[model samples]
Target chain A: MANSSDKQNRLQRLWTWFWSPAAVLSVGFTLIAGFLAGILFWGGFHWSLEMTNTEEFCVSCHTMETNLGEYRETVHYNNHSGVRAICSDCHVPKEWQHKVQAKIVAVKDVYHEAIGSISTPEKYEERRLKMAAAVWKKMKASDSRECRNCHEFEYMDFTIQERRAAAEHQRAIDTGMTCIDCHQGIAHSLPTGYQEEYQKISEALGVPKLGEEMTFSEAKSDEIRTYLDQ
Target chain B: MLQILGMIGANMLSLPGILGLAFGMMTRKWGFAALGGALIGLLEALLFAKFDFSQIDAIEMVISILIGIIACLVGCAIRRKGVLI
Candidate 1:
């Protein structure tokens, strides 16, 4: 009985304390301090997020050596304009919400790394098709958003492009086809049977048939044929 | 470069540590303050580190808890002395 009374007394005391007004420090000072702390916290979180987005950070995992080497050979790495698109540029989203979501999802990669899921070259090759399919699915769903960050259809000068390139780009824009549709092997080597894998991913994503989606433009057909032949 | 910068940014002005201080200042109860700081540290470490706990993470958590306790004691002392600032 005495213990129960003591508990009640303690609870009453806590309730009173909770309702009591602050005895020290101005409200303005507390608010300012909280605001400053918020800024610092946000800055720190952003710094860490960007840190994980670096190419160096991506390649730090031994399993990424294969992809890194392949990426190094791509035009994205070495171009005529001396511009470079690093790992994050191609993979991570730039928008705040999507970037945070991508980061959270990427924790699975850390789990895979810890478990050595693709630690060996052979293991990586074995899983390449599945992994590439996942990325292709994401890109297709997002309309190849990362690619459009730099390569916008409106900015392209089809007049100066190769005849075949011009025709293809025009067709892509007309059909609303994204960059990844035909540029799968541009950045990395395509896995064996990638065509079948991609077809499956497309069907699952409810995407229209790739080549049959829209009619091809007839403009510059002869030039495009000659260009392809050459 | 990014790793170094990130470590410096996160470690130097630890959000968890500051939160712990704020919790301590508000409650003026060392046990609650320390518990809150530890819980915050554990959540941050687990989420950010993704269960890849390191010695540095553990040390940071301990430091935050200590900071909470110290801040709570300081708040209690100030209240006892009726020092308004």
Candidate 2:
């Protein structure tokens, strides 16, 4: 009981010191100054984060040329709605915790860039499968959280969707399948043997192989066009 | 593990509330406290909202502001009682 009382007294003293207004400068002035400094620091940090999230910053590296070209050809870059998903929108997590982790993990990309790991198109192609697998593995593990930031399953209007898409989406919901489970090459070109790589990644990540046999055949492509035409 | 860490990081956003409490304690003024809290809360909400007003958690924002106000009021009461440690 004496030890507990001593601990409480110590805490009380600490609290008193913390809130004391006995500094050389007026406590009010100090508090306001510190508060403004905090704002500036936070603003600068946020600005830096936003600056790095831009498409120009992402494609600044010549190694990203291939991805930029592929992404430009996708509907995400050029659609009737004129909506655009920049590199960060698809690659970065919107959640604060995940975003910080992603930013930290992304520092490795700079190291690779400095070393010219995939500086040329040929070198990029050689490592494309492995790189794609890594991203797929992350997406699988996170259940494609970044994708859901823009494409929420709960908000999807199945009535306006193509028959195949509607059917597949319903099936996915029923089976606990995620967006990345079937939409591997939506924004970028799939590397050769991506199917095998994806399979291995899913297995390694312990994600259920829900769409193991699913493939977008030519008939489904025709159906998609028909649905779009309507 | 990541989620837990993320939550702690997010809670750091409330650090600004201390400024409100300090202002009230030093000035013994409720108006200054309210203004400080409101401004801080607004800035924080806008920062996180990122132009998407729909994404703002109204309840969380309000609660943060309320907590700041309460802390400031408590600080003012303590200082008014001549408890300047």
Candidate 3:
């Protein structure tokens, strides 16, 4: 009976100690330390996400490396004209149901990257052109919801400059020029590596000059306005 | 520097543990205190959005420090009172 009573007294003392102010303080300190550790480790997690997002990741084959550097430096990185669409942004639909469809389409890119199919600039350009055409077709059929997510009308309608630019945009569209024709360099800078080849092809095939000549500032103003109106 | 202030502010706004201390003290319930602290931190993150404090200037740093210290004290007091339980 004495031993049992002693054990009960000891257990009660332990329980009180556990719920004391000092114990609470210790727990708080431990939590604070853990929180700081999480913040420190987040950088690595963010870097991994960035690596997976790059176009180069999608085109990892040897043949694609030649053009990878140029693509990295493209206007898509800058997102100047507001129509800047990355490979996934355009190809992948926003809804969960369309995710599988996007993955299936992306498989071709993975195969090309893995199999070293595109050997030359010509081959790469051909594939890019086909992809661009498909994107254009999709844009025409729908509102390009993915692009509009970041470049929304309310977000774009912020300044006096944006408003003046919108008037010029209405005129441009009325003249049969779509947003992409003038804002071609929105995704990639003007005078791309493919420019000379594209010009040569235009001349050879008697294809009318599809792009317009505009200064960067003027182009940016017009693009901003177009986005505001949309 | 502004960056330091920003970081401190971010810590105050995002650190659930700091708020948890107060909640725990107030309620005298550790679990609720932790949950409340976490919820407040998450709410701040969702509403204001979190950015790198290293980009801000010295003024912001001082302000953030003031805010963080006050928050910490309040949280500690609440825990001591055991009102939350």
The models' CA-based lDDT, in order, is 0.69, 0.72, 0.49
**Weakest ten-residue segment in model 2 chain A by summed lDDT:** A212-221
Score every model by TM-score: 0.64, 0.64, 0.36
Candidate 1 local lDDT, A1-230, one digit each (tens): 99999999999998777656666868898779989998898899889988998888999999999999998877788878999999999899886535655666677789899999999999999999988988999898777989988999999999999776987898888787777777776678778887667667767766545555522322333344355334
Which tens-of-lDDT digit does each residue in A1-230 have in candidate 2? 99999999999999887766665888688779989998999899888988999999999998899999998888889888999999999899887635755776687799899999999888998999988888888898778988998888799999998777898788778777788777777778778887777767766766555353333422243354345334
Worst 10 residues of 3 chain A by lDDT: A201-210
Descending-lDDT candidate ranking? 2, 1, 3
Deviation in Å, model 3, residue A182 alpha carbon: 5.0
TM-score of the first chain of model 3: 0.45
By lDDT, the better pick of 1 and 2 is 2
Scored against the true structure, residue B29 in model 1 reaches a CA lDDT of 52
Please tell me which model should have the higher TM-score, number 1 or number 3: 1
Off by over 4 Å in 3: A1-56, A63-67, A79-87, A126-128, A162-164, A168-182, A189-230, B1-85
Candidate 3 lDDT, tens digit per residue, A20-59? 5664457678779878897877767546545655675645
Write candidate 2's Cα lDDT for B39-73 as tens digits.
Answer: 66566566666657865667546655665666667
Lowest lDDT 10-residue stretch of candidate 1 chain A: A214-223
Of models 2 and 3, which has the larger lDDT? Answer: 2
When candidate 3 is compared with the true two-chain complex, its DockQ is 0.03
In terms of docking quality, model 3 is incorrect
